[model samples]
Each structure stands twice: as structure tokens, then as C-alpha cells.
Target: MKIFNCAQFVRNLSIPTLKFYVAQHQLCPDLMIDWSQPEKNIPKALFSDIRRLEAVQADELTSLEKKQSITLGLVRWQDDLKRTFCMANDSAINEFRHALACDPEATVVFGAGSPEDIALWVLVYREKVFRDAELHLAFQAKTHGKYWKQHLIPKGLDITHDQARLDKFCEEVAQIYQKVGAGKSSHVEVTERAQDGSVQVTIYVEGPLTVIAHFEKNQFNRLSTRIALETALVYHPSNGIVESVVKGGAKNHTAVLELFGKHIVGQEITPDVVEKKEFRLNALRDEMLEPVLDWSKHGVHKVRLRRAKFTPVGRAGVSFQIDVPPDMDKPDAMEEAKENLRVRHYFDAEYAMESATLIVYMSPAQDGKAEHFSFGIQRLGASTIKNLSSKNQAIAYEVLKALDIIDVLDGPGNPVAEEQPESVS
Candidate 1:
């Protein structure tokens, strides 16, 4: 039995959004409350229903009811938006109750039993109405993370919205997941496809986990630990561009590309092309790095170059990483950093910049609460934009493209050069 602070959760949500979610989900059909006038009576009615449900002890629930509850819990927990909404609502309601209890004049409403315990269960009912809902906009408002971009060459395959072709692609993805030790259960589905033939695919893998110890109800307990991993990819066949937001590491990313090549393209991507892409940013690092440091013109403030990594020409094994302190704003810092590397014979000719990490501060919805977005750019046509809203992500991408940081594509015209040994100075 999990305990939730039901009162706190309800208080935090905008009344309109809560009303919308409740109405959309039909959470309390029996209450028969008028949703049109939610501000006047909906919150009170919702609390009463939660209290009644919570009064029913776990032991009193029938076997079928218990099973249903577990199933519903698992489903809601897996979704990003529903889980967030429930947690937020629960926290807000609990806080509200606490405030009321502390106030001498305000009477605390002690309905019955522990209503907080069943709050989440009540909100996330058995029905699967929200599975296809547009809750991403709401979820994005609450959380943030990094998104990585990559490019893929479709070769012979013609990208389309054909159902049979998409099903075949999903089958190949499942096979690839098995080969990569991802899991035996894998689901691949097309989430969206644009008019230009670019497709957004989502891959989910489930695997069993081993835990040494578990604790529940203040007693020793053992529970099944099955975890699910998700990866999102958008492939543009027109230009052979693929952008991925992966949930795991390099192996998972490699598995996705391998699936796309072997199944869709009908040809395996060569090791050289698969491993390295044509990234011209190294050659234009000096010209681009400075301009990006001052992004006030793009509506982003306090943009700073935090770190830069450089690999020596003809010496792939040797590299230099310079960390720029926040207070250090010297224009010659990069040059001086390279000069220091020359003394150690690590700077051959000119240091070819490989990657850089930049930190930018911006506010979402102009709410005055600025979030620190730290993003990294690799010369190998990969860039990571982190902790940004959807609008800010577009702005960041535009800024990077305008500066030629991520313009190079993975294609045949730009072949990877063989490495050579550096001559002794």
C-alpha cells in the first residue's frame, strides 16, 4: 500500500488543467459534479470521493480488484505525464492540508481513514484513455533533458508511410535489440510521420533486473525488478538525416543505426562511415566558438563557453581539454591554452578542435525563473542540447546551425582521412 498526499496534489494544479484532465479521463463519473463550474465545487467533491475510496482498506479489496489496481498502477507509472501529474497533485494537496492544520482559525477536514493512500489510484483509473493523448506539452512544462542528433543514409530504401514496410522495420528493430543484449521484449512503433516523408519512431525494450535486497512496509521484501528503456528517432530520408534521443549508451544508439541500415536501406553501413561523420567544425572552430559565447542577440543571456577539447593534427591519440572558469573571460584563453600544449609536443601544426561544452541561461515562457542549459557539440556531427523547453531547443538549434557548428552531414563526398604520426619538432 503506497501512501500519497492527496490534498497537496490537488492544490498545486491549475484548476482548469485539473478539470480538463479529470473530465478527459472520466475519473469520477459517479460524483456527477458539474465540470463547467469546477472552481466552485469540483475540488470539494473530488476530495470527498478520494476520502471514501481511501477508507476501503487494502485487505477489504477483492482479488480481482487488487489485480486491477496493480495493473492500472503499472500502466500509469510507465507514462511520463500521468505519473508527473499525479505526483504533483498529491504533493500540492498535502501541502495545502498542512497549512490548514497549522492555522488556528482554519478547521482541518479529517474526512475518514487515509485518503492520501488511494489518491494516485483514484486519479489513474483502469481505462487507457491517456495513452494517445497530447500530454507531451504538459510533461515538457515540468521536466527537461538532453536531446542528441545524428544522421543516417537510407541508401536504396524509399522512405514512406506504408504500414507493411513499417511493420517489417519494427521486426528488424526487435531482432537488433535481442542481438545487443537489450532484451527479449522490444516494441517499435511509428509515433509520427511528416509530409516530407520523415518518420519519428519510438523503440521500447523491457528487461529483467537483479536486486540484492529490497525493503517495503518497513520489512524485508523481494520484488520483481523489470525495467523498460525507450529510444526516440526521427529519420529524414530526403537528406539522410536522423536525430535520436536515446535512453541508454553508445551500444543502444549503434543498435538503432544498424537496424535502420540492415532493414530499411538493404545495405550494412561500413565501419568508417558508421563510426565517423563528416564534421567540418574542427576547421572553423576559431571562427564559430567566439560568436556563440555571446548569444544575447538570440534572446539567450549569460552564454559562456565552459570547456573545449582539441585533438592534435596527425596525432589522434593525443588531445588537450581546456576548462574555462566562469570568471575567466579572456579572448586569448584558447590560444594560450594551445600554446601551453605545444611545450609538451601535443600541439601539432594547429590543434584541431574536437568538441566543446557550452552553458546558457534562459527562461521558459518568460516566467523569470531561468534554467541553466548545458549543451555539448562534437565535431563528428553530434550535438547535445540539454534542459531546454521545446521552443528554446529550436532556438538553440538555429543558433548552432547559423554558426556552422552542426551543418556537416554524414555522406560520401566527405571521406574520413587516415591518421598519421606527428614529426618531431
Candidate 2:
């Protein structure tokens, strides 16, 4: 988790990339004598300035002041790059530029941090600007792991679990990738095979950068355009669930699923048949019951209802938010409030429970240190766990799974339970 310095990142950049930025008047504009001919010595001055800023002693400024200075420096760098891209005439670049324009806090999107962290953000920003087309296609393919969504294939379908079928499916996916303009060159390959009778396939696509400026003379330019989108397909034969991390959006997701059905299952798969795993209001309530989750068994010491929000169905722009005291050990008050609202027809069968925040006190594990973490659970399967450490996330996922909140894929193509219409007693 070592963060690299921004100065080091800048120093590592190829001369051509530095020249490209300088030529476009993106860096150290005041030092450039001629806009037409960017001086090779400009990087030295730029590096010197960045190093000087990095060399500032901690005692010289307060933490807040240092952060403010770093933020301003990073924001200025991002703004200059954005301004240059905004003036680009290319359609793809223009589209990206428009997005950049819309995102006023683009520099801080990755979160404000140390100069090294900001340096990584700057690198990402540069890639987005220079290789907008490739990134766009990769993004379309859902290259980012966090955003990967899951879908279940019907167990009733006659799925042929063999190498031949998988090979054929990969071929079809490659063709589809090209047809969908994912890239100029595309290939699908088997990336991993799990011992649990699951296989992972990756769809890689490469295309030329959409920027108007040509960087043919630059050695680094070759890598800039080689978009290797890891659109993964992890098929679990045990339950017929295909965890898809695709590049394209919903349309492409459907297309790929259709092909998956046709090639592997020998059947036509429609959106209706492919079940999406999500949390239902009733399921949430059911899981909250004591019988479902034994806190002691799950190493949970205590649970507190922090907040709950609900919207009455058919009520336009109306919602209710209940904020519970975090220190309150008993959830009886929140439960009573819900009952009160339900009896009054405010939270009846027509009510849609949106989300709930919970503070869970976990029993000490091997580390032997008890900890309490807060997390929010949404109806659409998005749960926000405040502590982003992998261990904490895994624990959260485990707890949610135990509560039948997340990854609750029961049976093949089992649709998420619909909200039950409860008659007011």
C-alpha cells in the first residue's frame, strides 16, 4: 500500500508524453517561450517546482494548510488538462471533455489524500484523457471490479458444461465484442479455473487512441492504445450462476447473456429469465428476526439500529426517515415506530423500505480486539461498509450472507422475493 510520490510519477513519464503536455500548453506554460515548439528543458523546471513543494517540512505548516496547498496544486494541474481537452474538436474527446466539465470536483473524486495518492489519481486522469477511446470501451466492458454485477442462468436450461462449448462461447463473445465496437482488435481467453468447478473467461480488446494528436514517434504511445479490458465471466456450474464483469452497459450485458444461452446452454435466455440478486423488504425484515441471525453464533456482540428510511408506494416525492440513537442497545423503539406508522397507513403494504443503517458490534477474533462498524443496506444490493479494509469488507459480506442480505442466490434462476402485500391487522 505504498503510495508513490507525484514527482516520481512525473519524472518517470516519457519525454514524448511530457512534450505532448507541454506542446498542448498543459504544463509550466509560463516557462514555454514558444507554444509551437515546447522546450525540452521544461520538465526540469516542472520537476524542480514539484520537488520543492514536496520538500516542505511538516513543521513549516499545519496539516490542514499542507492539505490545502496540495489540493490547490492538484486541482490546478487537473484544471489545465481538462481545459486543453475541452477545446478538442474530436467527438470522443469532446464527449469525455463534456463529462469532465460536468464533474466540477473531478480532481477530488478519488478522495483528497497525500501527494503520492494524488499522483496516482493524476496518472489515472492522464490515461482517461489520452486513451479516452480505449478506456471508454473498457469501461463499457465493465473493467472496474467494484462495479461488476451478477446474473443467474436458469438451472432448467440444458447447459453443456464442457471445454468445447466454452471455447465456442468465447469465439462468439469475441465476435460480439467487435460488432459492438468494443475495439479494433478483440480476443476472448480462459483466464482462470477454480477448483470448485468454476471457470473465468476474459474478453480483451485493443484499439487506437481517439486523441487528434499523433504520438507515433513516442515509444510509450504503443502502450497507451492497447486497451486490455478484463471483462470477466465467472460461471459456477454448481448453481448455474454466471458472475459477469462486462465492459458494455445493460444492452451489451443482455447481448452477452443471450449468446451465453445460445452457445453454452443451447437455449435463448431473456432478461426476464435471468434472475438478478437483490434484497427485498420482506427478506430484510425476515433476516432481522432473531431466528434467522443468532448474533452470538455469528460473533456479533450487539446490534443497534442507526437509521431507517421508507417511502410509501404511490406517494409522490414523500419519504420518512427515522434516526435512532446509536447508543440505544434495544431496537424496540424503531420497531414500535414502524408499527405505529403501519397502523396509521403511513407504512402499510404500499410502503417501500429504502435503506437501513446498522451499527454492528463484533466479538473479538484472533486479534482479540472488539470493534463496532457501521454499514448501510439498500434494497438494490448496494451495502456501504464504512471501513473499506478487505478483512472488514469480507466480514461484512459474511455477516450479510448469514443474514440472507447479499449473495442470496438460492436455486437456479430464483428471482428475488417480491415485497409482500401485508394487510393491516
Candidate 3:
């Protein structure tokens, strides 16, 4: 049959089709784990014997792709491999959620196989959930015509006797009536009516996964259309590397929307709303930057912050002046100095939390390159230090006060002193 209104049909089928693919890769052979369970259902398995099952699947998936099934020998080998891996790493897996948070994308936690192997699958499955939603939306937008006639329309087109006739009508309409003048056609009212009646839906699964979309007419349900629509998403393949995380404005919404096309054109948030989002984002930034402040003493050289500006990306940024010893980078200079020369540090900033942190990155030269640093700051709240018996709020307060000083200095410094300082104080 000629393709008439495929967009609507594709969107309708998006969820089920994508779920089928995830089930193939995710579901246990005995169906002990239900891939359809949403995020909230995952807390129990956070400490379950999930690794053994994952390892078995990994081995079986590899062998099955090659030979199509686990033969008797393969089964025996798989069980033996599971026994060995489980014996070695079962307890460690349950204890190490934050152990690999340093490199969340590439970091591995314990599983039936290597933590690396399990992390690889985790990232993959998460993306599968996203991509499935995305493709559905794209398909729906592409084939909305088919959906309009077959599903959205009150009296659906008759397809049993004259499929060709219906297809031809849809093709002609899609091509000839693709663009309509405002208020020129009666169908616009009907289309708008369908959209208004449609329900916006979202499904969030634990393990850092979420699906958002809508149910329109009968067939098309776009899952998590907003984030999936604009962001460039990719599921990691085995041994794949994710270097950095990008938080785009499109996917990162200030508030949730119930319907897909209900665009917030002129809506403005109250000052209080803006402050809330900023406060939370800052809190998260502080949490992410906490590790850097663990060590107090500098190893060899000290870094001085001269100037800094908050980048549009909203992370810690700086224009630093470093103290470099003479002859440090000379051809015959000792190897260690070369490695420790560069500067990298991060400081966390939180408005509500009375505490923050400064992290210093010390990357000494390995073979022949100059070293670099990475630094950030994070603010603490009731939650971050709720469990610790004794916590330090001094550093956070001091750093924030210092930041105020920097802001003042950078804003309206002494133009009279532009001549330059006479000597280092």
C-alpha cells in the first residue's frame, strides 16, 4: 500500500516498538525483571543480585548473536563464569554506588561481569528508553496525516474495501494541502480540537532514566517528546567513552508541561521561580565539586586567583595568575616540575547552604607534557551533611565572602592603579 499518513501511525507505534527492542536486550530469559517497570520500581533492585543475571545475559547475548542459542556446553561455561564472578564481586557491587560517580558516564560499578561491562549496558538501556521516545515523536510528526484520518477523525476512513482509494486521497491531501492559510480551512478546527483533548504523559524509571510523551487519538503516543526532540542523544556501545555531560536548555525545563505542542510562548516565571531553579542548580554544582576540597595542603606550587567570570555554561570559571619558578620549564628542568606546573581548580557556590568547597586538580606531567588542573565549588545543605556528626561550615562561608570580594574587584576596580603595581607584595 502507498504510504499516506505514516507520521501519525509511526508516532502511535513508537512506544511499543521501542519497548520491544529494549525488552530484547533488557529482559531476563526467565522474565524475572520486567523491563516495563517504571523508575520508581527500581529501588528494590538497587541492591539485588542483578549482576549475576546481567552477566548471564551478556554472555548469552554474545554467544547467541554468534550461534543463536546457548548450547549445553555454552550453558555450562556460562554458569561457571557466573559462579566465579559472583563469588568475587557480589558484595562489592551493593556497596559502591558512588564509588564510580567520578566518571559517571564511563565509570563502572560491580555487576555479574566487569563493572565496565555493566555500566556500558546501563548507559545503553537508558538511551534506548530515550531514543525510542524520540523516534516515535518524529514519526508522528511525519505521518500526522494518517493519524488525522484514521484515528483522530470521528468517522474514520474505510480501509477494508478500497485501501488504494483511501491512500490516494491521503497522498493528495498531504501534498496539496500541506500548508493552509490561517482560518481558511475547516480541518484546522478539528485538528486543534484533537490536540486540546490529547493527554500529556510521562514515565520516569529509576537508574537515571525518564520518558516523556503524549497519547493522541489512538495509535500515536510520543514519549518524552521535548527533551528527545531537540537534544542529540546516543546510546554508548561497549567500551564507549563519554567525556563530559552537556545540559541543554531545551531538555532542562524549569517546569513540566503536560501536553506535547502546548508551547509556553509568552509565559514568564516569577522572580521566586527563577531563584528556586538557580538555587537547586547551584546546590547540585556544589555536590559535584565536593571531592576536590578533601586535601588541604598544596603539594609543590600555589595558584592565585586574579580574575574570574561566570561562563554562560554556569560552572566555575577563572582567569588565574600562577607563580612559576624560573627554569622550571627549561629543557633540562626536572621532569616532576614540568608535570606540576599547570593550574586547575573548581569551587562550589550555593546560596542556601552555608557551606561550599574548593577543589584543586593536580595533574603532574607523565611523559613530556605540562600539567593541568580542574577545580569547582559546591554548597552544602541539611541533606549533604545531615548524617555527618561534625561538619565544617567555615570554608563555605569564607569562600563565598571571598567571591563577593572578587565580584566587587572585577566590577569596579581602581582605574587609577592601571599604571601597574611596582613590585610583588
lDDT of every model, 2 decimals? 0.48, 0.51, 0.26
lDDT of 3 at 196: 12
lDDT of 1 at 354: 72
Tens digits of per-residue lDDT, candidate 1, 1-425, equal 23434454565445654555556542334334566664756677766764454343234554766546644543442353335444333333342334234443223222321333223323344122222111222222222234343545643355445666656666666565555455666666553222234455666666545454677536897776656556666565565556555545565567767766666555776322234443455533451254433455566654555677777676466777777655434433355465566645444355777766666655344566666565566665444442243345555665554445544242122212110011100
Q: What residue runs in model 2 are displaced by over 4 Å at the alpha carbon?
A: 1-174, 177-182, 187-189, 193-197, 207-209, 212-230, 247-251, 254-273, 277-293, 306-309, 318-351, 365-368, 373-376, 380-425
* Cα-based lDDT at residue 337, candidate 2: 50
User: Which residue pairs in model 1 clash with each other?
Assistant: 7-93, 7-94, 8-91, 8-92, 8-93, 8-94, 9-89, 9-90, 9-92, 9-93
Sliding window of 10 residues with minimal summed lDDT for model 2:
416-425
Off by over 4 Å in 1: 1-10, 24-52, 55-57, 61-151, 155-172, 176-185, 193-197, 205-219, 229-233, 243-303, 306-374, 378-382, 386-425
Q: What is the per-residue lDDT of model 3 for residues 1-425, given as tens digits with 9 covering 90 to 100?
A: 12323222222222333244234542334235454576444324321434444455456356664333323333543443232233222222221332233445424223233532342233344433223333323322322111110111111111122334323322332232223211111110000101112221222211122465656434567564212111111111121211111122322221221111122112222211111001122322221222223323323122222112122124354322222223323221112222333424323221122222232223355674543232222221111111111112223222323333122232111111111111111
**Which residue window of length 10 is worst by lDDT in model 3?**
187-196
Which candidate leads the pack in lDDT? 2
Candidate 1: give its CA RMSD in angstroms. 12.4
> What TM-score, over all chains together, does every model reach?
0.51, 0.44, 0.21
